[model samples]
Structures are given as C-alpha cells and as structure tokens.
Target: MSEDVFAALEESQQQSPESVLERLIETLTAQKNYHRLFDALLMQQKHAMGLEVLQPTTFDNVPDERKKEFEEAYIEAARKVGNLFLDEKMYSDAWLYFQTIQEPERVSEALSKINPRTVPEDKVEGLIQVCAYEGANPEKGFEIMLQSNGICNTITVFDQMNAQLKPESRKKIAQLLVDQLYTDLVQSLQYHVQQKMPIAPPADNLRELIAGRDWMFEGGSYHIDVSHLNSVVRFARLLSEDDPHLAKVIELCEYGSRLDQQFQYPGESPFEDFYPAHLHFFKALVGEENDRNLAIGYFEKKLEMEPDEDDKQMIAYVLIDLLTRLKMNERAIELAETYLSQFEDPNTFSFTSLCRQTNHLDVLQKVARGKGDLVTFAGALLDAQNKPQPQES
Candidate 1:
C-alpha cells in the first residue's frame, strides 16, 4: 500500500508539487508516521525556497524574504512531531526534535511523568543523561539515578555537576542526599545501639542517637560511609537555612566531629577545621544564638589572622556573606566597604549589590569616588534619584 502511494506521489510530483505533498502528508498521517511527516514538511518548505539541501547551519543562507516563513514552518513541524513522539512514549526520539527547536520544557514535562521503576534497564542511562545532565528535569533525573544506580553513582554525578545547574536544582539534589544519608545513619545507629542495649534508641534524631554512645565510636567505628558523610555535608551548604534537612546535616557534622582525627581532613579556609567548622556554620545559619556569636567571632579572627592578601579577600567575603545571612546588613555593608570596595569585579561578591540591597547607595557612592570609578559613582547617583522620597508631614 505504501509502495502504491509512493508510486502515485512520484507521478503527481512531475505534474504538480503541491499534489505530491498533499498525497505524502495524507499517507504518512494515515500510517501515524509523524517522524517522516516532519521530514516531509521541511522538504516541502526547502523545495519552495529553491534550496537543494536543508541543514540548521545552512539556514543563514535562506532568502531573507522567506526566512521567517521557513523558520515558522520548521518550528511548527518540530512541535507537531515532538508531541507525537511524546504521546507514543518515545522520549529519546522526542528529545531530538524538541531540543532542535529549543523547547526542552516540553520534553522535560513528559520525562517527569515517567516512573523510574517502569524504565527499561537499557534506557536508564540515556534517560538519566537527558533528564539530569542535560537540564530537562534534574530533580526527577537525580531521583531516577539514585534509585537505579545507587548513592555512590549519584554522589559522583552530583559532584561532577557544573555551575550551569541552577542553585535550586542543586539544593533539591542536596536535600535528597541529606535525607538518604540521614536515614542510613539512623538505621545503622539504631541497630548498633540495639546490639548493646536491651532496646533500640528511642529518638530517631542523629544527635540523640549517639548522645552518650561513645562506645559506638570505639576503635574508629562509624555508622555511614565517611566519604559520603563528608560529601553530603559539603553539598548541604547549598541548602537554604530553612530547609528541614539542615538540622540533619548539622547532626551529621556533629557526628563527623566525633570521628578519630585520622578521619578529619582539612578543607579550604573558613572550613579548614572541616566538620567542626561546618557544624558551627550550619548552626549559625539556623540562628542558634550561641553558635551565631561563635561563628561571627571565629570568622572575624580568621579574617584578622590571614596574612595573604588573596586569602584575606576570600575570608572577608565569607565573613560578609555570613553577616548578610544573619541579617546584620549594617555590618555586611561595613565589611564590604572596607574589604571589597576596591575590587571592581563582582563575580564572587557584589559590593554594589550589597549596598543597594541595604538601601545604602550612599556607601557605594563613597566607595566609587574613593576608587575613582566614575561609572559606579554615576550609577549610584542615578539609583539614589530613582528611590522614593518621603514627603514633608
């Protein structure tokens, strides 16, 4: 039947191109062959434009008079074919068309509906690549990877994730890790405590689990994988202060601090003490009254003692960020004015943004004038002018 239609299409093409396209579309649509229909539509558009070949790179050479028409036709065909592929549960094939048309949200939405358990073993990795690494549905992708490939692989992938992944996406993955590790640690602790005592630990909280169980740490014993613990604690920094998992993360830090010194490795400045520093940092982030003061004093001392100018800058930013997070905007502005104002690049920390957020453009103006940065000085003046002024009572 297809051969007969193709034979007639060939004959019709010689007589009339429109007749050939109409016949081809009718036949492919009857057969539910939307993939081929997509190609056929593009072929018809290119034929109309007198182009012998149709490639994305060659689109620039398309006649200016008809470029919009050609692009619109291409987009329409891509959407039609991509939707058909999605309806057929052909996600990999659907991604090709939707991606070409810069419509990842369509593919992402479809991929999100898939249950990880029902995914074929052979197709798991490809789906993971599209959903997680390619930015389609990162949370779902990470979930699928964790459930299918296990925590080790998920952690490796999470660590390898570049800066292009949005902070919210990273935070979601971090929350998953914290939950997973928290569960594992609690189970392990419960079992161990059960072995020694007649009953299990009453509290599921990590801090409560090991409150007086020094014997649990005997001979350098640990409940969870120490490496996983370290990685998740580091990743948990990306989590927001209000995240419920933050409490578990701090508990993990406390557990890490109890480990033998051999397990305690150093980290970058401000976190050089590793788990202990993170415990204090996370505690301070959650507004723990004593830890807040301790964190402030600790970072202040580190900033004062650092000898290297570069290291000092890094430490100063950390202190400033901590101050800002604590809602001590005045102190943050002071630190920014003192340590960061001289630096023009705001990639790491924007002094201008800090000043603006605190409604202290006057401080920015002062810094800009001191540095002889006319652009910023002028910008501050303009922003100050735009701010709403109070009327006389």
Candidate 2:
C-alpha cells in the first residue's frame, strides 16, 4: 500500500518471481477485501501481463456475515465469466460451469439457476462430446476431478456431460459415469504413487510400505525420501492448487525449503534452500509472497499443529532448512540436534555439530561407527574437524 513497498516490489520484480510476489503481497494486507482483491489483481495481471496468478477464494479472508455474500459473488462472477466465454461459441456449447464447481454452494446454485433446456443445441452436443473425451472417461470423471490430485479439464468434460444430457441418455450416461469412476480412480491412484523423473524406486507395494512404518516412520514421510521431497511438494501443489488440499502442498514447502535441506547440508548457508518445490502453488494460493519472518512463522505453526511423527520430523527439517539458508549455523545445529534426539535413526539423517557449541570433539561420539548402517557423514565431519588449524605459510 505504501509507495516505498511499491518501489520495493518494482525493484524485486527484475530479480525473481517469489521476491516480487512476496513484496507486493505485503501491501495487500492494507486492503479490507481479501479474495476480491486477489481475484481483481490476478485477473488484471493474467489478462494484462499474461502472468498466471491462481487467486485464492478461501472463506478465511471474508467476515462471518459477509461470507455468504462473498460466496454468491464469487460463484456468480465465475459463472458469468465462464458464460462469457461460452457466449463466444458459434454453435451449441454446453453451460459446463455447474460441473466444474465442486463447492456445495456453487453446485446448488448452478443446478437451480441454470437449466439444460436453456442451453443451445450445439452446446449440448459439445457437452456430450466432452463427456466422452477419453481423458474424462465419463464414468469416473466427476470424482477424479474432485479428488486431491484430481485434474480440472477432466472435470470440465464431465460438467459438459451434465450440461447436455437428454432424458433418454441421462440414465445410460449416469451408469457409464459410475463404471468409469472406478477405472479412473485406479489409474489416478497409480499415477499419484508413481514417479518418472530421475524416477524413484518402484512403489512395489505402497500399501504395505506405508503401513509397515511404525510410529517413528509413518505419517509425514508418505514413504518418500529426502531427495524427492521437492518433487512431491511440486506435484502435490499442482494437484490441489490451494483449496484446503493446500495443507499437503504447504507441508512439502516446509520440508524442502526448511527440513530436508537442513539434513542434506548441515550448517550450510540457508539461502541455498529457499526454493520450496511448491513456490508456484503458494503463488497461486495466497497470491502474495511470504517474507522470511512470515515463512518461518508458517513453519512454526506447522510444527505446532502437526501431530504425526514423520510430519513432525519434516517440520524439524524445515526449521533447519530455514536456518541453513539464512546461514545461521549455530541455530541450525541446535535445532538439528533436537530433531535427531526425537528419532534416534543414525542411518537416515545424522550430523555432528559443526560450530564451537562445545570445546570438546565429543559431538561425533554418538557416531554409529561403521557397523553396516553407520552413515558416511560421520567420517566426513570427522575429517573436516580433525584437519589441524591452519598455520601461516
């Protein structure tokens, strides 16, 4: 809101998206309206500059009494906007807005306010065609589109189906919809568990794997490794895109930007770990950049709120991640030790204190010492520490 913040945003824009977005968001706090402001700015940014900002429409920003009004406005705007696009259709195009919206309120309005009979014949035909799209797989389409990792275009296809069905085909289409749902679910779940890039090890038996991890290893890990946290975060975010499924996305950000980086590079510079795999997701959800302080606060909130052990570890890692990025080794070491104390798993993530936390070299005293699962990290730290203090040449 201030000219100084505006200048800061302008300056940051040249450097990186996250920076500019973050600084600009600080100004938005002054605006009384939340979702509307985001929608308006994002609409302008996307249309004017071709920047795709996913404007969040969460109810948290709206006042209690005004929530219903905001909801109506949002749905009405979305429908109107969607219809505006449909108006450009030369022929029949189904009014597919009803199907794409999953919010109970929007769904009810769409059902009550819009009628299939009122839609154009060609539009009805288009709806049927979209329903039949191989991707939509009509039978399973609606559920898939609503799931955590559900796709949007697929939902649109289903909406189109809903928009154009005749009384005769309605029952048939409904049955087909039920049948394909199971099929699509199977496929989507498989896709959710599989990875291709630098592809992860086969999730040969994910059900068993996730289930087998006792209290210490279950929950937060989701059976993923430290290296894959970013990819998971990115994919999770793209799947949910901030609509309550947002929590998972944020978790990934905390893990990668704060936690995993801490474990991988003990006592290292923290700035190196700022690119939470889901920056794009955050950009889309909040439409504002969170500063270091705010980001740190989010991490703290995560740690406090998370009840699961693995998730808690992930949160701990995030603290380290932030510390490492900020080049706060002493703080990072303290946090890391605290984290290690929680789960005593030397094989997975173990690091000795690098600073002068104590004058004695006893930090590595707990090293597992090469009885098979002893990590090589102990050796690396030992060698680095034992190297005699340098003498003037």
Candidate 3:
C-alpha cells in the first residue's frame, strides 16, 4: 500500500507546522507525485499559516482544545496558499482558495484583491460559486463583478450563476435580486409622487416588478409584510386621484390583494387575517366610475370572498341597498330573503325598511310569517295596501 506521506513525517520529528510543510514540499517534489503533491502543497500552506484544514473528524468526538487547534491550523494554512497565489498575481485563484476559509470577512478580503477583468470568461461561474458559499453574501460578490466589469457583464454573469446553482444558493441569489428590485420600486414611486409626475409609468413599473418573480412576495421574512402591501395600495390610490379612470389602479389593487391573500396569520379574526386595503380601493373605484352595475358587481364579489360573519353581513347590506336604489326590487328582495333565512331570529336583520323601499312587502310578509311573527307580517301587508304606487313619468 502507498504510505501516507505527511502522517509518516509527523511521527519522525516535532517540527512546527511550517517546517513540516516545507519538508513535505521537498519530498513530494522529489517523488514527482503531482496529484498528491498539489494537495500536500495546499495542506502544508494551510498548516504553516495556522489555518484549519478540514478533516473528516466528528466534532463531538474531538476535545475543545483539539478543535481549537485544528481551526487555528486551518486558517493559517489557507492564508499561506492565498498569499502565495497573490504573490504569483493569480488573484482569481487566490479568491477561490480563500473562500474555503469559514470566515466571511476573510472571504470578502480575498474577493477585494481580485481583478474582475482578469477573470477569464470561463472562470466567472467559478468565482460566483465561491461567493455563494454558505457564509459569503452573493450580493457583495456581485458588487465586485460590477466594479471590475460593467453592469451588462455583471448581469450576464449573474444569469449564468443563477441557472446552474444549488437550490439554497439560488434562493439566496433570488432574495438579493428581489431586495434590489423592491428598493428601486419604492424609490421610483417616491420620486414620482414628490415631483407630481404622471404616475402611470411608475405604477406600470411596479406591476412588472411584482410579476417578474414570485420571490418579491416574500418581503424578506416568512410572512408577507402588510406595510409593504399598503405602500403599493397608497400609490395606487394616489394614481387614482390623478387619473380616476386609470385602469392600472385596478390592476394594482388586484395584484396587491392577491399578494395579501397568500399571507397567513395565527388567528381566526378577520381584521388580523385579512387586508381591507383592496376593499377601500374597490369602494373608491366604484364611486369614481359611478357605474351602478360595477358597484353591484364589486359588492357581490366581495360578499362571496368575505369569510367572517360580520363582514358578510356588512357587504350583504351594501349590496341590498344598492340594488334597492337601482329599483331592482325583485333581485334585492331575493338577496335579502336568502341572507335573512340563515338566522333563527330572521327579524334581527331588520329587512323591513328594505322591503318598504323596494316594495318587497309580499316577500317580507312570507319571511315574517315563517317565523310565526305575524304581527310584523300584518304591518307590512297593511303598509303595502295603504301606500300609493309610483306614477309613470
């Protein structure tokens, strides 16, 4: 069997790590064992500089002192190889080597020393790979690329990395990209509002960004941030004020509402779990358009979506009132009867006024009679008989 060269050397003398590394260099060179020779060179360099060389030992099995010693040794060895690479003007190689060090600040240092342009086009991926290693921030590495290469070059390199990265690494890259996009969106919207510029362009830009990737909805945490969503709602409202007919406002509200829907809160409470911004937007939209059908349609859709009992009741009332005003008495009475039937005490909903306005006395009397509350039914019948019908205009 081939002997383990470094292990044998360690038993022969109590040489400092550096001296042992120097001896290994001499022996590996004499043997011309290039494969093991390169490994020895990197290992010895780490040893000589007191950098940790990662070994396959279990941390639980190792004593604290030994763990500390190995860590220190690993860092030293890594520094030696990195410095050696630097001296040879191999900045890219040096950066890749230093990335193996567990510390982030040192990796950043190695990245700083690299000349971005000198990195061969083929090596761009390798550079990005090292940067995306666990502790290193991918954005900081991209910044280095930006400085060395232009934005066009940096983006091209980023696309390549994104296509061939690990899932975790890809997620990190995605997060950094989304964060920059969010910042730009907020800044652009703010500028548009401050200068009182036409909001359509910024609003369109925001919609595009939101649709650009799903990661934007993450909002830098586990759940979506309501504040971030509210900002978009506020921007849409502002745009609506400037151009009441702006179709983009409706689109923004829809998109924001969809985003808000994906968030889950801990409780069953409607106020805590659901967002009301979209409702407000829809209400404002209905008022501006003054289209009776649109108002009716919006309220009906909202009534379908509202899960809470109280919210449903409120939306149903609005819908029934709007229907009465439009003189769609049959439809209004139908909706009122459907909703009022859900309760034991049907009179509690108090549909008498709605019946009187819409001339839905017969339907109300039927409902009142079903509950064995004939007194209320009798009054509705009497009112219907006494009231004068409308005259044709």
> lDDT (CA) for every model shown?
0.84, 0.43, 0.54
Candidate 2 has what TM-score?
Answer: 0.24
Q: Which one wins on TM-score? A: 1
* Tens-place lDDT digits, model 3, residues 1-393: 246765667854585656676777678666744334456765654444455644422234345666776566546655666666656545455565566674346555656566655777766666655554333446556755554554445545656565445444444433433343345445654454445444434443455544544554545322224444443333232222234333444444444554635443222222232334344434544454455556566667777888877777766765665566456678778888877544433323467767766677888789889889878889988998998979999
Candidate 1 residues 270-304, lDDT tens each? 78889988887888999668989998998889989
In angstroms, how far off is 232's CA in candidate 2?
A: 8.3
lDDT of 1 at 89: 76
What TM-score against the true fold does each predicted structure earn?
A: 0.87, 0.24, 0.31
Candidates 2 and 3: which is better by TM-score?
Answer: 3
Cα lDDT for residue 15, candidate 3:
57
Give the Å shift of residue 344 in candidate 3: 12
Q: Mind giving the per-residue lDDT tens digits that candidate 2 earns over 321-352?
A: 45554555666666666554334433334454
